[model samples]
Target chain A: MIERPHHVPERLGLLSGAAADPFLTEDLLRGVQGHGGVDLAKVVEPLPEDDARWAVEPLRDLVDDAMFQFKENRTDADGWLAPRLHATLRLTRREAADKRIWNHIALAVAPDYVAWRHLPTASEGKVPRINPVRFMGAPDRQCFSRLWWAAEMFRNGADYTPVVRACSNQDLIHNSLRVSLVDHRPTAQALVRILERGTATTGREINGLITAINTAGATVIYDAFAEDEPRDPWALRQWITDAESAPPVPRHVLPTGPDEEPVREDSVAKLTEYFADLFETAPVRGRTP
Target chain B: MKFYPYKRLNRPIALRVMSATLKLPDGTFDPLDTSAYSVPQRTVALGVAQHEDWISARIGLSATLPPGATDADAPWSGLRVLAVLTDGDTNLRTTVELRQDAPDSKEWSGQIEVLRDDHAGRASLAAYAVATVDGVEGRSITETDADWTVDVVSEEPLGGLRLDVKQAGFSKSAREWLRPYADVPWVIDTSGRLPLVMINTDVEGFSDLLGGNGGGIENKIHELLLSQMATDVWTAVFHSAVGDLEVEPDGSPVFPTDWRGEVLREMLPDVAPGLHVEEALRRVHRRRTDDTGWVELQTRIHYAAVRRAGASKAVANALRALQQMNREDSE
Candidate 1:
């Protein structure tokens, strides 16, 4: 048996300078080997090997592609990577809610990715460090979990296009996901539509619109107007069941969601109109003049 | 040397009445029932009775005399003499003076002396006097100058329900309600169930439309409210039960009679109802079934369409041309 020596690259700053000396690439590979052959299957719990969704290689490849694609613009990676990651993962909402699985992925399966994606930048003469919460926190706060949940909540049925738009606007995904109301499909869709239409181009505009909508909701009943189709529970069950035999989600094109009915166009139109009306009255700081 | 709660000098006059009776030769001269004598100017009146040279009279006194004054003036002295008048009328007038030595002390005493009286009676007479008191003058007292202090406890409870505006999702509503008294201290408990929905509209211009101040806090609250409203609407549409739909094994409702197809068929009357079923089935064919080997063949066809779309020739070229034309016209 041969023991591999830990190797440190020449550039210390390439990886976060805050990491300890032993926390290098060779050490990470050793950790992966120690945890059973760098297969994410060994790391995640409850999911059996036979489950087609259990394959981690495809996801690792996708992550690599994302890291390569957004090499220059790390912030822009969230919008592009989130929906694709969700589509490729192909898990039921029930499975996605499991924090243990995300914890394992961030800690054991892909700690390097977490480090790469979320290592904080230095400011105010102080060295920046990653918060531990990003690896194992609530769904709305954890690094990968937040992105995955954002993708799930924002995507239209059988359409990941709207999700891309929503995620692209950092404020919309980051702020709206924390709010319980974004759980509504039509509202999520309508919000994305507002962005797509260029009704809200700037971050300030997005913030103002969000504020006005929240305030107006005190008196208005948004549900009374924007009706959505009842989700067929069997469809979701079937979608989850199909995971064992389902093909890999396409890398180049957006993956299809479950065949459940999309939000009604009329309802989305109504909300968009209502929200537009609200934004008109909302007080924007610079626009006060 | 006796001290009362109220000084005798400050106390109003106390009036006392005394009477004596005179006896007449006839047994009918009982002064107890003497209604004959009347005095117009007398402040007090007395009645007398006489029986076999033994006589007595009853006297009544007025309450208008000076404090501590005694009945020793002209009217009272005249009443001591028994002068029978032919006119059969007797009356007396008198004045009483009250004196006090201590002007500043809480403990002070006074005496009253009655004066001036003219009375003429047959055998015995009774006399009475009235008393009066003057007002006391002093400076106003401050709280510090007072000897004793009184503290009153409020018999009422504290003000309104304390609410945690953040948790209750009523921060905005609570703020709005409390806006008029912005400077006043208020206790808000935000633990109560909020009736309002918290929406998060992360879109531009929406918050302004809703009349929110587009500050970060206000915008965040607005987005929360909108999100809640959207969820409510979505839940109502999707989760509500209908009589016609059959519940699937997994608890999803299914249209037992192809009801959805029927509606679509009816809307597009030109398309035969049977053809609508075929179209729906064709759309369904795009989905994969575990038992059906037909999925592979169907996927192949889909792949071919996708490949053609990707390739720079054939159907893809035609579609691209059409899309380009549409874009040009819109521009």
Candidate 2:
């Protein structure tokens, strides 16, 4: 695998699609060649120089550690990297929505990580290419973004433990992230609890359950039945503000998220029971009556 | 009315916004502009990006249930009214309980708190009357007929499909991308947070063609040009919306939650009449992916786009103009 960028910037920069496309070469995606930092640096639109949050070296170091530690099991990296990535790179949803920053990170800072993580297994004669979507696509598909958003979605306020459990199951994140139904805090927690209980272990079963939950959500407002508390916005703002002075997220221990209150216990219990009932009748492809 | 399997209040609940205030960064409350809300449209624009620092908003709500709601013979007991604030974008729902004005009175009032950080853009505020019925707790009996929109980031107090329109000289514009399309009269970009219609000022008289309010042929032509632009925009956004749908485990397409959902819900009926929006979406998805009947569906898509653009109305006006012109020429 290729090494990290030779010269990391002081702060992160935005890389537009027009600028990033040239470096996304077929050879680089196929894992044979890589883009050197020198040429790619010219096109990057740098973020504000004074913003401490935009610093790049910490992010580079984190990804490096992730690659080295999970060298044996690539999929295991997701569970480890998600919470840490979210905690280390603190951003508001508005800031995170900007694709340019994610593009810069993928193409300029960590093309090697993207290639190593997403490069497909080799066939007898077919070339194994990393999907471009992993580098620069929708939030649910992109390599780094999917993890960050997974943590944001599954994290019960200040808790990051649930995020780890959600990321452990790739099928859960891959299917659940696309649906709006999971945005409900109780709904998100209930799904995680279902996963932990080993009710819907397979990808097909998880997919079936998620589909049923979303379809049923169209008519039934989950929030009404499973009531979630009003989140304290001050807690979230304080969390984002504290990122400036906060220390590096500990490697061994899971990092904490925003200080807002977790989903109510009764609410999660209500949805858990409702979702379990739905799963019993959900049309899993191979499940027999 | 939407049907409920369980017993519910037959009459709709009367809900209204009493007042609204925004909390500033320095622990002070600023009364939001009275113009922030549109009663007819059921929308509240909590100012623009300037209010981003505003921590939270408090909206005073008043609701009156029907006469028999509080009677002894009422079907359900333990009745409670709640004001709910929900943002689909963030998936956050906050509910506040409302107390009765007097013992056994039908009137209820309360203040609902809206956290700014919990919402990214627009959140909806609605009132629901709930009570235990048939052994089910927190069962909704009635709700506001139309939920009010609370847009934290918009300057205009309006709701639904507010497509942005801007004018810039394509050749000399700050947007480098538009320079390449300098020759085109207008362009529609659906990739951003909201759909935008960029009118090229470099194309001389193009703005005049679109903006002018003249008599006879000039007016007719202006309307036609606008209709054409609207047609293109609706078509582009519709294609963009339907082209990228998330599928269920059983291979059925799921409706999007963003502006794409708005576009689909608005246009799907015209695209496939007499069918539910979900069914229409499925048909559209099947046609596109299976590569069968897609070519045939183009006419329906075009017709839908034209209907939304009001092209038929423009054509009617143009016909009337043509008839008048011929009569004058013959005279």
Residue range A1-289, candidate 1, lDDT tens digits: 1112122111111111111112323334333322222332221234554666666666666767777888798777887788877876766554564455565555544666666677644468864655555655546667777788788778777778888888888778765664434666777888898898888767778877776776554323344346566444456556767877777667677777767778889989988887776777887657773
- Candidate 1, residues B233-278, lDDT tens digits: the string is 2222111112223332234433322122222222222222234443
**Which of the CAPRI classes, incorrect, acceptable, medium or high, describes model 1?**
incorrect
- lDDT (10s digit) by residue, model 2, range A167-197: 8889899878876557677888999999999
Off by over 4 Å in 1: A1-46, B1-331
- Deviating ranges (above 4 Å) for candidate 2: A1-49, A98-104, A121-132, A197-200, A204-227, A265-289, B1-5, B10-15, B48-52, B64-75, B103-107, B144-146, B169-174, B205-224, B312-331
Q: Write the per-residue lDDT of candidate 2 for residues B1-331, one digit (tens) a residue.
A: 4667777778878887777899998999988767877788788777656666887888888899987888898888788888877665555567788889999999999998876666667777888888877866667778787788888778778777768799999888755656668889998877555778999988888888788877889899888888999999899889988886777656999787667888999999989899998999999999999958989988999899999899999989988999999999999
Which window of ten consecutive residues has the lowest lDDT sum in model 2 chain B? B86-95
TM-score of 2: 0.84
TM-score of chain A for candidate 1?
Answer: 0.81
Provide i-RMS per model in Å: 47.6, 3.8
